[model samples]
Target: MQKFLFELNRNADFQSRYLSDRRDAMNGFDLSDEERHALAEPDIGLLFHLGVNGQILMHFAAFHEIEWQDYLQQMRDGIAAHGPVREGVYAVTGYEGVDAHSSRLSKTSDAEKGS
Candidate 1:
């Protein structure tokens, strides 16, 4: 989990770009049925990416630039009220250098850890 979080920290710029594209599609733009389905599916990795992405995009769209501090607070609030960004995922805090609820864990590891 921490590894994925570190990966996100390093690739924040790329993630921002992805968020921009996703926002465009969500805002009355066209997408193929499959693409729409992909977004709709309950994939934790996708949701995490989207949540981070959407926070940045929404900040820009709503405020004309990234207000990350506020965006983070808003994202946190939204997640708390609604639960995890997607099924089988959660919003974790206090884990250093990691994405909370990282989906990188394998089934074997989960079994070993009894998670």
Candidate 2:
């Protein structure tokens, strides 16, 4: 996962290369089929749930033209739909109990109120 993210960040031509030929772009990586599918789908939620680092994930989100807020929301939605973060930096003990939709609504309301 880190290798894939690194390539996406370090290679100037990676996006074009990936878009043009995914199999070729991914040829040398040691990713599992599931990981490869996540990348292909650019499923930010699943990627986060799979324990991708935030720094790496942030860049990946940018690569997909997703804004920061949406990126965060996607992570939350991932938890809501797929359960807690599985590992890595974002893992937590009680995420399964979190009410993601209500949390999102609260945050949106707070933002609207200039808070």
Candidate 3:
């Protein structure tokens, strides 16, 4: 994942090569079908859910012209529509069982009651 992002960002030659022949460029990497599909679709939400680092993802989003707000919304939508992050640092166990917004609201309510 990091390698793919790096190639997109750091290697102009790779970019040119990929632009000319996507399959040929992709063949150079060892990637899963899911990873390949995500890249092919440029599924930012899925990539984020898959735990691509924010720093890397931010640039990728910028390259795709996704605004900051839109990028965030896409992540939230991904969670709502697809379920919790499947892997990586952002993975959460209970996300599948509750609405994140409602969970936050419940916490806020508890805090208010205690106060």
Model 2 clash pairs?
none
lDDT of each: 0.42, 0.81, 0.75
Which tens-of-lDDT digit does each residue in 65-98 have in candidate 3?
8899998887777666666777765665434433
Q: How should the candidates be ordered by TM-score, best one leading? A: 2, 3, 1
| Worst window of 10 by summed lDDT in candidate 1 | 88-97
Worst 10 residues of 3 by lDDT: 89-98
Per-residue lDDT tens digits for candidate 2, residues 3-70, read 78878877879978988877668878998887888888888988888888889999988988999899
Candidate 2 error regions (>4 Å): 92-115
Per-model TM-score versus the true fold: 0.28, 0.74, 0.71
Model 1, residue pairs in steric clash: none
What RMSD does each model have against the real structure? 12.0, 5.8, 3.2
Question: Which candidate number maximizes lDDT?
Answer: 2
Q: Where is model 1 more than 4 Å wrong at Cα?
A: 1-66, 87-115
Choose the strongest candidate by TM-score. Answer: 2
